[model samples]
Target: MFNNIFLLMRQELALSVLVFLLLFIKIGKERSNTSILNFVNIALFVNLIIGICFVGKGELFSGMFATNALIILEKNILNLAVLIISMQSFAWLKNHDQVIEFYLLIFTSLLGMFFLISSGNLLIFYLGLEMSTIPLAAAANFDLSKRKSSEAAMKLILSSAFSSGILLMGISFLYGTSGTLTFSILTAHISNNPLQLFAFILLVSGFAFKIAAVPFHLWTADVYEGAPIAVTSFLSVVSKAAVLFTFVSVLYKVFQPIASTWYLILILLAVVTILIGNLFAIRQDNFKRFLAFSSIAQVGFILIGISGSSVAGSASLIYFILIYVFSNLAAFGVVSLVSALTGKENISDYKGFYKTNPLLSWVLTIALFSLAGVPPTAGFFGKLFLMMAGAAKGNYGLITFAALNMVISFYYYLRVVKAIFMEENEAPIEKLGIPLVSKMAMYICVAGILITGLASMIYDYIYSLSFGL
Candidate 1:
């Protein structure tokens, strides 16, 4: 039993140890934040490498937790994301007083995400969800001197509590009807009855809130704008990736019985989410808020893939997320560096930025190009596969609509690019000193975006996992 637990939960176990190591370091001596950050980054990189090299598969705790090739890949994707984030946060962390607390919160949320991904039952899923969310709420308040930071934390807490209630109510309804919480059993028991559908809607609402889908996305912009850049990056990349991964499992596996019903629901939500997210994003002068809405639009694209209800759909979703991690983080890396150096976060502040900061300008341009789904970038391939997977359902109209929305997305994404290169500013941001670690992180993200797009084999490997499943 012990061996099974260790084998099945190696990722979670290792992360817990890393968290403890950080705790011990915090208590032992008063080290410089730079040293602590260096230590943490090394540990995180080690963790990512270990996860990739030592993948495991099985179930434990009477099937309450499970792990497979796909889940392992999902977890490793997150590991890489956290490592990149830790690297990118170097400038911010080295100057902050609460470096250990920041990392502790990050790893705790990551540990919860590990459990959340492995959960085999509703109870375990909800437990993991709360564990992941609470830490992030605290992290949002890390900028203690800012009133907006406190407001961000408060809104997060209240919204989380509300979403948790809705989710739990859905779980109760599901259990009441199905008499089981285990995913495998729930799959067989899911029926398209009124109460069951209602429960499913409530559950999806909770998920929508997490992913920042339209109408449920009110808290996202405020939180992203108010939280420090590090937290915002974590929220945009790591947090969304975890929820979307689990959501794929729940909808495609556990609720497979009511596919048609949920497919319609997903379609409706995806269209609205894309339209609203894009429209609002265009109006945002605040860079963080702009990215917030952009992320919401990205979620809509993810839904189009999920709606396909096939192995292709699952593969596309994961592949796109991998591309998304690189693309989004690359953008955020530039944002973090610029914001940390200049205390600037507005779109107007970036006008003529390329004159002084050409490297960062190009990096952000590439990242935004990828986000806009432009060709030759990995994001283009990601969205291509997504739309192709969605097309498998023979809904050409919906596919065309999605494609058109992609054009809408392109306009706003390029707006920033244009500001950087084309617009003139008398007082542009100065040529700032870019940290070595942050530059390294940016290079990795740029490589990921380029390599993933060019390498078809990566997507093939992911598809093989989905097919095997």
Candidate 2:
């Protein structure tokens, strides 16, 4: 019983303690804010280690919550994400006056995500979801100097509220019909009735908004453009990935009975998301907006994996998300560095970037290749696994369409690559003196992306997780 309790709340407990300690350091007689951040980082690193070591899979809280390979995987992923967010964004935060408040909000949001990932019931999930989102709106408005930031905050809050309402409506329908909110019980209760079908659609559609999928993705570009780069990266990677993880879990675990039906719906959504994201990405001059659309397209591929609704599919989906975190963060790291140094974000501004800042240019190049699914990067293997998983489900048409779209994606990704490597600007970006922490973050991302691609152990472990279940 003690072991189960330890395993269950270890991550959250560690983080909550760290947050409190950090707050103490901030509000204490010592006016040393840097100490708070440094201590927080060290504490979080320790907490991540605790999560990895305490990994056990079972139910707690009378089965309202559960833990398993998926739960462990997601917690570790979130920990890694939070760590990177802290390290990479720390330099930027130090320059701003609100660093302490910012870190507090980030940790708060991360704590919420921990609960969301562990939730086994709709009630718990909704509680965690709302908890995670409310802080993020404040983070979006952290840049109070910009009107767009406040505008973005409003949009995010409104959209999140709307999505939550839709999700609750779906849950209400499920409860009305099935008389249970627990996913394990729901599988036995759910039937292919028209009301249940509509409920499931509401649920998936609500999550689609969270992940910024097509037809529900209207607010994404504005939010991405207006939020601080750190916040943008957080939203793009952590928030979207967590939502994807939970959404896939609920559907595959509870709604397995309607796999055939949702499969087609997912395929259709995937096609439109890919087409719209890739097509619009080509025309974007703002790098952040470019990433926004590019992310939408990437989510489409993720949908392909989810559509499989099998162990292989979940493995691939999880693997893809891991690499994606590294890839997208690398891109954002470069963009943040360049924007800080030169105030240039347009693709054209990248011309001759390689001449002055080869490291940033190369990092962005590698990230773009990975994003475009080029060979020898983790992104390539990520896409390959997702495709194979989809194909296993007889989703050849959807997979083929995705492949064609990949080719289309390469054109736009390479356009930026060409500007950096091939084109020349009379005034190129100046040389940069990267801080130690930011450089460490970049090296970690680059090494992880390369090693995960080259190493078979990574995929083998993922497949083991899939097969074990």
Candidate 3:
């Protein structure tokens, strides 16, 4: 047992050491921070390579640290998200102080997420959750001059505390009912006990907060509005993906026997989240807040995939997340570029943007259309798979509601496109030159959105990969 723990600890520790080394190099230097950013990016890429090489399916540390193909894929997705986020950060971090510490926090937060996707026990999961979350709150306030940033930090902390408290209570209840905290043991122990049901509700509530499900999503818009665009993109993509991955694992492995109870609850939550998120997003003029609400609606669609609780469901969820990472990153990248150039985040500020920056404007248009489930984009296929997964289980109502929500979502998504192309400008807008690395990252995302749909070979590949899990 000690040897197993040592091995697992060593693997994670190596990544930690790399992160610190980058931090040291960053702070030890003087003057411009561009080199440090470049170094961090290289380090992240190397760490991802190491993670890929170390992909052995096993449980370690008495099942507290588990690694398998599914977890490895999830971690790789997270690494991709981090790389894209770091690229986005370049524009935001120019001339910013404490740049070294910022990169350190980002790496640390990512490490936490890696642990979280592989966590095998409740305690380990909670530890990873907090480790990932606390630094992000600080990151939200990285720009100390802005009062809105500070408010975002406060709201994040408060909401995280509330969710963590509820999670602890849920863990206590589960321990009391099953007399164990290990997931494998819990699967064997869970019965139709009322205590187990209560524990499930509590656990789901904690996940609900993390995923920004309706009624628990009041903080999402404000935080997205207040945080830097890079940070907001991280929250929407990496953080939410971790939570959903863990949620699906728990539901399928630990609580499978109680599907009837949880399924109804999920169905209700999915309906409300889809409806409310779409409705609220329509009124948002702030681009960041609009994306925030759009993310919420996307979560609802993913929930429909999850409700099926099959291997196909899990595959669909993963595929949806992959598509979303590209589409949303593309949207945010364009928004970040616009905001960096014009110092405006409002939708109205984009009037005649196409005339100024046709390349970026078209990128934004494709991203939004994909998000609205228009065909020939990854988003369309993602939604198609999700609806197919739900419908496979004879969930006609879920499919119907999801379809309706997609229609509602189309209006707001197109509104942005209209603002960019159709609306008249009062003044001549200057086109800004984007950094080479940032431009490459955005183009990569755009290509991903376009190609992922055309590649129908992935369906068979996903089926085979998820067969074991």
Candidate 4:
């Protein structure tokens, strides 16, 4: 039984241990921020490796928790994302007074994500969701002296409370209708009943808030702009990826019986999210806020793949998210470094940026190109697969509209590139020194952006794991 628990819940167990280790360190004597950061990074790297090595399939705690290759893979993707974020955050973490506290908050959120992914019961799912979400508000408030940071935390708390209430109401409705919270049992109970459909809508609303889908995305730009860059990266990449994984799982599994109904709903949400995200992205000046909208647009694409509701859809969505982790984090890495050094977060601050910092400028360009879905980058192929999956249902008109939105995305994405390489600033921000750790993280992201798309086997592997989904 212990062995089963160890193997089935290895990812969550390992993360929990890491969290406790950090807590102990915090309880002990004072240490330099650098030492704590290094220790935390090394420990997290080991935890990530552990997550990859032990792959199994089974249920624990009477099916409240479960694990399989695909779930394990999902957790691994998140592990990799958080590690990269930590590496990229070196520039900021080395200086922050409460480095250990920062990491604790991140780990707490991550532990929640692991549980959320492994949850086989709605009770477990809701517990995990709250665990993951509550810590983020604290992380957002980490910049304790900044008014915007406080405001960001306040907004996040309010929004989170609002969403959690809606989610609980939906869960209550679901339990009342189905008489059980177990996913497998719940699926057998689901139908096109008006009350059930309404519950599902409310549930999707809670998820939409997490993924920052349009209508619920009003809080995103402000939160991203106000939070520290590193926190913003976590919110954008790691947090979104975890929720998306669970979102796909819940839709594909628990709600499979209502496929026809949710399919149409996803279509409407995808179109509106893409259109609104692209239009708003074009108008943003703050770089974090710009990427906030960009991430929203990316979620819109993920939704397209999810709407396919097939093995192909599952495979494509996972693959796209893997690519997205690298592409989005690369963009945030640059933002973190620059914002740390110059305290400038506006688009205009990058004018003539390439002339002074050619390498960093190119790195940012490649990342933006990937995000814009430009050719030869992983993002292009990622978007391509998502569209193909979405078209699996013969929704060509929807695909066409999405394709058009991609073009609109290009205008804004390239607008930044053009500023970097072409537009001139009279006094370009001086060539700033890039820290070795941060630069390493950037290189890793760039390689991922370039290699993941080009490597067919990666997608094939994901597709294989998704076979029985």
The runs of at least 3 residues in candidate 3 whose Cα sits more than 4 Å from the true structure, single-residue gaps closed, are 1-14, 467-469
lDDT of 1 by residue, 1-469 (tens): 7777777777888899999998998899799888888899999988887788866778887889989999999999999999999999999888999999999999999999999999999989999999999999999999999999999999998998999999999999999999999999888888889999999999999999999888899999999999999999999899999999999889888888888898899999999999999999999999999999999999999999989988999999999999999999999999999999999999999999999999999999999999999989999999999999889889999999999999999999999999999999999999999989999999999999999999999999999998312
Candidate 2: pairs in clash: none
Candidates by lDDT, descending order: 1, 4, 2, 3
Candidate 2 ranges with C-alpha deviation above 4 Å: 467-469
Q: Tell me the tens digit of each residue's lDDT in model 4 across 233-296.
A: 9999989999999998999888988889989989989999999999999999899999999999
Residues 58-140 of candidate 2 have per-residue lDDT tens digits of 88888877878768878899889778777777667666777778878878888888888889988999998998899999999
Tens-place lDDT per residue, model 3, 1-469, is 6666544454466568877787667656475678777877787777677666655577876789897777777788888888887887677776677777787777788789878888999889999999999999998888789999999989998998999899889889999988988998888888779888888888898999999999789999999999878888999999999899888888888887888888898888899899899999999999999999999999999999888777788889988888899999999998887777678899988889899889889889999988999999989999998888878779797798899889999999999899899999987357878888788888889998998888987665665566313
Scored against the true structure, residue 110 in model 3 reaches a CA lDDT of 78
Local error of candidate 4 at 139, Å?
0.6
How well does each candidate superpose onto the true structure, as a TM-score? 0.99, 0.97, 0.96, 0.99
Better of 2 and 4 by TM-score: 4
